[model samples]
Target: MDELSVKASSLGDNLSAPDGSDLPEPRRDFHDEQYLSQCSLKSRDLLLLTCPNLGLQVCWFLLMSSGTPYLESLDISKSITSLVWLTGPIFGAFAQPIFGILSDESRHPWGKRKPFILCGASCVATCFLALACAEDITDGPTNAPTADSDSTKHWYTQVFAIACVGVITFAMQAYQSGVRALIVDNCPPQQQAAASAWSMRWNVAGNLVLSTVGFLDAKRTFFRPEGNAKFKILAVVTTACIVVTVGLVSYYVADSSQNPRGKSRQPLTKLCWSMLCPAELSKHWNQLPPVSHRVCTIQLFAWVAWFPVLYYTSTFAYETVLPYNFARELHEKGQLDIRLIEHAELHRSSSMLYFAFATFATSLLLHMIEHAMPAFDHTQPRIWFFSQCSLGFCLLLTFFARTGATATIIISVMGASWAVAMWIPFALISAEISQPSPSKLGGKTGWILGLHNMAMSLPQIVSAILCAVILGALRWLNIGDGIAWIFRLASIAVFYSAYLINKL
Candidate 1:
């Protein structure tokens, strides 16, 4: 969120010249320049490089909406499903930082970020393929699906699916660190905000595409009977997209680094351990300036409010609005009804569409704010504060949302908050840390980006751990569906998060 007034001089100094020149340009275009001033890359060029996010978002939305339900489809117990729900946050918490440090330390010929990005994309694709074929691989005598009479011989498939999820989640986390670091490593300071905005916009666009696909697939019951074929197709489509986009980006987009070969560190293991170690991080934490502290704090509060909503909205809506005949179907047929699954899928996709649409609108709103308020780094604390409050109020309305439209509308409004939560904190933190010395920040971009990711992943882990207990307590209180109350509690967190913005 760099102020427009002071950007030209700072951006020029921060950006390197083209044609291997050491000199910085007198001024650079905030809108036109992609990463380097004299480099031919435009913002649209960077956008094309970032299209891999489209694939990532497609896979992510599929997992979030369908992963737990897939476990249930395998007839896995609630306990395992709940544990599986925690996988992304748990793996992400560790994987992102490790990937960050590795990318920061990498000296590959392709570039620091590209190698990790390619590797991560490959691993994710492999895992998705395995997941897509889970049923086929596990259809032997020990793991084959059974009839209604006997216990289903599908627990083995369930195990395989969960394993695939774990591996995929970790791989995606690795991919995320590299993808996010690409912007930091390449984009000049002035365009960082625009970079973040475009990334978010692309992210929402990806979400929108997947949501529409899911909705249509669900409506048609594209995968009949067990309804797992759609996921297989989704996995295949997303994997292909990942490989192509990541490969294209790797091949075409050169990283704008003056020093392509950074000094190699000591033992890789020790460096990774230090990066992952809380004790080691605390040392660096103590050295950071106040703005850095504020950014992290805001991230913590904001994500604590956000992660639960992201993880549980589908579950909550399924349980509350689309309550299917799970018990009756289970008792009579020893499996949940396909109708129930279809209903949930429809709701999940429809709700996601609204979420994406609102995110698009919110992005525009943020753009207006940035243009209108130039001095405060294109962001006002009060505006962010208001957005959070509005989100909390919208979450409050979730309690009364009876129909699908009601839920969609409420969550759509929550998008404004999500936009700010996702965009501003990263912009603020990156800007704050880059100010002391842009070159140093460039060297540690991956590390700092990793720390910022921790500010996101850590809260998700906390929320995942606490969600069951909170929902259980709500159920004990005998309120109208404890599952639905998760949204209400999240609203409370959002409100408190707004109060914390004053400190920023």
Candidate 2:
């Protein structure tokens, strides 16, 4: 919930003062006395603030699990649906920074980030609703005006589905930016690592929701379970979660911007300049505490592995299952049907469920390990190095997987590192910025976090490009199976990232 930000009492116009007189903790006692008294947060408070992430995560998983298939159901070609997945990376690269800047500068009396979050969440919810009712909305509950009605309705639904996905992609970027900013803005510096762990915990919960929903038979519902009924149920659950979690933090958390005056927009020229050549941000980049830079670099490489693996996991599961189930032979013999695909996808859902539990268990186990073996944690400084080594091994292992269960187990073991990847970087960055700085970092929380998000997204683009080039070269040369090379290359990248972790 509130884990995205630390304490307003701990934070302000400037996170620290020069001459080392002020660090993340201390403030002008006399001036901040009343504010700190009112705004100081407990562990429970941080939990409340971060709760919104749960709903946001559900929205994310829904898209990953259902977006393309939903479009396919509308009679859209598989090729077009595959391309639709690109919208997230493309929009994420641009949207996070823009929204971060806007949210940081917001002077809304209600709060700085909540207003943007509200707008974005509303739009996302609306899009989900539209997707859930695409057919009914495009045509009547029963429409058969002419012989051409089926084609006309399918066309309408196709366009409607695609449009909704586009809106959801952009809106989610804005919403996520705001929520992340809200978290960084509110939590105390001391709890960042815990916050990161909590973020992963919530992510696991979202995965559970996806797995549970996916496990349900489409025919399980009482009325019209064939078409969009499941999506409708998911939409209702997602909307309710947003209202409850977001509404809680919005109503309970104190306003972040102490400044009562309205935050005004910058001139277009200045805004563009800030985006293109932010001199101030560049200075901060250079001055970041040692660990922050190393973590950022490592994160970049880690995502090189993650980008392909995450995007391809469902396909990987399908393919892996097909070989074991004899579906591959059937396909080779030109026998394809809905049942065969469904059988394969059933295993995909099982893989996701297995991975979710692994991640959740790992997230919890890490904390216990830290407490039980303080000296071990000291060796890697937050077990980051350990995570990298395991992560690299897991990625490398993917290339040798020959069964659906084997692939699933590999993904599950990856939880050991995935837990760290989710929270450690954000926690590290937040801590670094909060420490005394060589440059102006005050009120730049959003931009700094935005840069981190950009780092993650940029890798997706690179990995996508590299995948294309590698695949193309393989086909051109008529080489042996090149798909395995993807994992090998990803493993190499991860090991290098692990090397960087040692530097950290």
Candidate 3:
């Protein structure tokens, strides 16, 4: 009898108490039924969770809006400078995927996302400083012409600045991935779209902040912002925002530490091997459902359509338009130098801020429509389709822009599309994977989202490569207003992207 009883207890999870009854196991908080059933977080918690993105968005806009012009300010050839632009998309290609894998599998006590967030924020601050100080440290000319560079002179300063930008892009991509995964982790699957919508709102808010700030003259204020001084001002302002927002979110928010339901971790070496190997990672890709594939495909083309616009809008304003505005007078006076370039870039930068405002305004309108009429939810695909097509039409209009102001107006209107693009794809992905409880993709949410990000980055890579080849040819032929034609050409891709969205 005793031997039989011992076998029974051993076979079962229950122990043989004095009464020979099983004791119930302790309930886990992470897997609490009540928590899983909740659709969304409270407004306060949601705000805290999304706060970091505000600063991050501002950092990204500052870079995309000004980086090209700033690089040109150093007198670097656009062909060679296009190579610097290439680093952003190159690192972007892998940075999110690798960071996503790491964040998903991380067993850190401080939290999976927190460590990455902290590390990325610190690196971003340093990288911005490095970019700001590039000319000073490498002894490169602080002010190069906006219109063109003298190819004969070579400066190591431009090289160092380029390196800083590359490092910063990787860090930025990782930081953004962490924040995104953290939001996904904290919310229930049902709230994925809402969560993504909130994220987009924060992004728009950041742009509004930039639009407000762009009007002020840094030199007129306390900073005396000119040349590298503007960059320093940018770096310092970003640092303050990061410290406040990232610090708050990282401390106040929680994240999944490897597994939410249980403590299990894949071997670290194996995870690293899977990340580095295309074949190994392909296994994870297969786990994603059809919706993930469709959404990611759409994102791929959508970004391809947008990269040139993002990178070259300011360039279009500065290169194609600014030349007509100021270049003729300055060239005639034999005083075509740094001041002319600075003023032109500053003017274009102010105009780019209007692009931000457009994006912000559009996002606000969308939120209102969605809130005021829940029935409009059915029209998302249609809304996305038309919005994207509008950008395509705007790109075609770029071919006819005779002045910087006209080009600025075209870029600003494109932001309405930008608003939709930012929200829908991510919200769709989140909604898809969440509907089936833990999801078929399961613990691989981070990996799946990483792949989605890869979709966006890869096209940018292709776009950058194309830009380099085309700009080299243009510069070689001594052609101005070439970017206008490039924009008209790119509109084809955007229209096709609109078709893809309609198919969705």
* Poorly placed runs, candidate 2 (over 4 Å): 1-40, 140-149, 218-225, 259-265, 277-290, 323-329, 332-343, 370-382, 436-438, 468-485
Q: Write the per-residue lDDT of candidate 3 for residues 27-97, one digit (tens) a residue.
A: 22333334344323455566677788888887887787667657888887766767777777777777788
The alpha-carbon deviation from the true structure for residue 423 of candidate 2, after best TM-score superposition, in angstroms, is: 1.2
lDDT winner among the candidates? Answer: 3
Q: What tens-digit string does per-residue lDDT give for candidate 2 at 291-310? A: 66666667788888887666
**What's the lDDT for all of these models?**
0.68, 0.69, 0.71
| Residue-by-residue lDDT tens digits, candidate 1, 193-301 | 6667667776777667666677777677666565678777777777877877787767655653223233555578887777668898877555555665667667776
Q: What is the TM-score of candidate 2?
A: 0.84
Report lDDT (Cα) of residue 402, candidate 3. Answer: 77
Best-to-worst order by lDDT is 3, 2, 1
Give me the displacement of residue 462 in model 1, in angstroms: 1.7
Query: lDDT of model 3 at residue 161?
Result: 81
Q: Positional deviation of 500 in candidate 2, in angstroms?
A: 1.5
